[model samples]
Target: MTADPTTGISSFDPQRALALAADTFQNEAEALLAIRAGLDASFADVVRLMLSCRGRVVVMGMGKSGHVGRKIAATLASTGTPAMFVHPGEASHGDLGMVTLQDVVMAISNSGESDELNVIVPVLKRLNVPLVAMTGRAGSTLARHADHVLLCAVEREACPLNLAPTTSTTAQMAMGDALAVALLDARGFHEQDFARSHPGGALGRKLLMHVRDLMRSGDDLPRVAPDARFLQMLHEMSAKGLGFTAVVDAEDRVQGIFTDGDLRRLIERGTDLRAFHAGDVMHRQPRCVRDDVLAVEAAAVMEQHRVTSVLVVDAQGRLVGAINSNDLMRAKVI
Candidate 1:
């Protein structure tokens, strides 16, 4: 019988609904904390097994566990641990060859009784591969066959129906993150190493890119002789659009620099432009950096001095290149 959807308006209490949401969040938080408290030597064993492996870490699971396995594999791969996801059901259909004796297999299952995963256990054992099992039950068959068991047991499912996988998956995901971080720390993975692995990401650009890769070189650099007229320096600065011009000596060594700030000071002091050369109004011994410096370091220098541009010079103090805040901005290094 069809009934009005809004007929039970008064029966649906708003206060009760708010209390239910709060209780659900509090319960899930407690379950996660309980799972964290249970971590022991087995967790370290899993890290050691993965570290000792000469091949990739093969992750396997079924249903929702499979989804979490895929994410864990991706995180591990990006964080310096070579890992890949393999569905247990597909492993039986010739994907088992992907597993090698040198590889470590991490199988994920809540009850540790997933039929698909069970089917691959014998084959993995036959291959003599190391197995790291992530499951709720430490005494299950999957755990019994594994070399190391990572228990991700949650007190209860967050789902109101208590049938869907929710809190368990969250616990599993958190454990996976912990494993990846442990491996990352053990391997001494640095930002440069991470950048090498993720060259297309922003962090990679900041760590891997050098100033020479983004700085203005050759004709693009704005330079004028120390004895050059103020109008000539202005023309060079205007042409380069770096808001500054370098004043160099005959040896190509930077004697000083004229920036927009210098121009403002000149105007405020009412200096005669007609008699002035670049050296007469330039800032002497301006801040400079080497061409080989990282773009991230260049950004740091700019921020340190509160300047927008920096001159790139060689060990001999000769002007070689130049870079501005705009360059760093364009490179996404800022």
Candidate 2:
């Protein structure tokens, strides 16, 4: 147990350090399991009340719990439920007016005795708002006044000092996630609904944005008749800046595609470019997609085949549009 004089600290033992880490993880896992088990009839009641709320759910807490409350409110809002976070301290300074009688109040306090939160309890009750409490102590004032209680009780703090909120906060966060998922499932929230809530996110782009929105249509689409010469197709590809040109038959059906890759191969093989038509040099039955498909899905197809561009066709296999990696990049679907 002697300290190392050179380092001026106790000698570190790797085995002991690893053991402590394992114990901490085990304790947190057990605490979260306890919180999960606690989700019973009371949890159902909370969901029922929240679903029935006509106004937004006002989530209020203080200190570390407030940070967790903000995340919970965001999760609730993004998933079918309308919610917003209100600081308990701010609520006392006339911010309490934000909570309406039709709204539901979700209060978070590990001790359930946070003085700032206690100040607004009576006002919330006077407003006749439903109070849902998330805390460790059921007998605590906040829990006593709550219409429903979510028990986030834990065995002990993960902090070595036992003063910091660690395991308890983790339990609370997991419980909040469970609540959001339950509500989302109950409301039958779909990907399209989620896209509406998160239009700026990747999933939103995948679900809401179509290939037509990102494809180069009309004159911008690099296309030429099958009878066009190789040089003509190359010129079209260069002018459109798509690195490829669609070779179409008289019926406007996509007959083939000639890209910069084909040009390189032709040059390597010393083919007479002047005498070859687009039909001779182009790749027949090139990868094609529908304009109605998601731009994200188009990107996936391009990446899967290691190609830079794809031809967009209609149900009749007629060339209607074109897209490249640049198009996906511009649309932020990449």
Candidate 3:
């Protein structure tokens, strides 16, 4: 029973706090499991309704449900389902114009009777938009007016008083995720599609960025003719600072590659470095990728071959560019 030095308030019991947190986890996990078990065809019905909707899925809620609704809308939109969150209060004040006959309305309420949300139900119906309700109460006003109902009921909240939106909100969040997963699968959404929607995100950079988007080309690419002196190849490699140089023929077709590692191996074998030509010292059949290959694919090539740099070539097998691990790291694609 220690008193706080700052506020002179009694310090909380750590064991009691931990116990409460554990109970919250258990309660939320159980709620999600229950919802998973109780899911019926209504879930599919909602997915089908939204899939058929030509306009966006307009999500609405109040308080904590509103917060959950916003996240649901974001997940849906990023996962190939066009969606937006509309505040119920704002909807009554001309924002309702956003809802059209082609849109689908998803109203979220734990009790399924949020007055603000319920107020706009009639207007949504009048607009002839499909209404999908996510609620804990199947018989409540919001559910009753909905074209399809997604039951998010829970036995009790993790709050000691069973009043706070704890386990209930968890259930709602899980249900929303489930909906997003199902909808994405139904739409045949791919990683490229998700990347298109989130170009600034890490996954987008990895999936959408191609070798041509980041590779060094032209004068920036370190290259030398097969007959060039070893010193000239070293100078090109040093000038480019890519730790490697490609050995090409007069037609700019890649014949081999000389890297710092090859230099070290040659020196270790006591090879005559001064008398060597680019073709003589370079390693034949160097690992390379097409300019159009995904940067992540290039990373994979580097990983599989245990190399830090990869040569980029065109359809005619001509040297077009060079990409290294550093380039991928700079682009955050590795």
Q: Pick the candidate with the highest lDDT.
A: 3
RMSD of 1: 2.7
Q: Candidate 1 at 330: error in angstroms?
A: 1.7
Q: Is candidate 2 or candidate 3 better by lDDT?
A: 3
Q: Candidates' lDDT values, in order?
A: 0.90, 0.90, 0.92
lDDT of 3 by residue, 151-245 (tens): 99999999999999999999989999999999999999999999999998999998899999999998999999988998999999899998999
Q: Local error of candidate 3 at 268, Å?
A: 4.8
Q: List the residue pairs that clash in candidate 3.
A: none
RMSD of 2: 3.0
Ranking by TM-score: 3, 1, 2
Model 2: per-residue lDDT, tens digit, 105-196? 99999999999988888888888899999999999999998888898988789887788898888888888898899899999999999999
Instruction: List, in order, the clash count of every candidate structure.
Output: 0, 0, 0
Residues 152-225 of candidate 1 have per-residue lDDT tens digits of: 88778877778889889988999999999999999998888999998878999988999899999899999999
Residue-level lDDT for 160 in candidate 3 = 91
Clashing pairs in 2: none
Candidate 1 segments exceeding 4 Å error: 1-17
Which lDDT value does model 2 have at 333?
85
CA RMSD of all predictions:
2.7, 3.0, 2.3
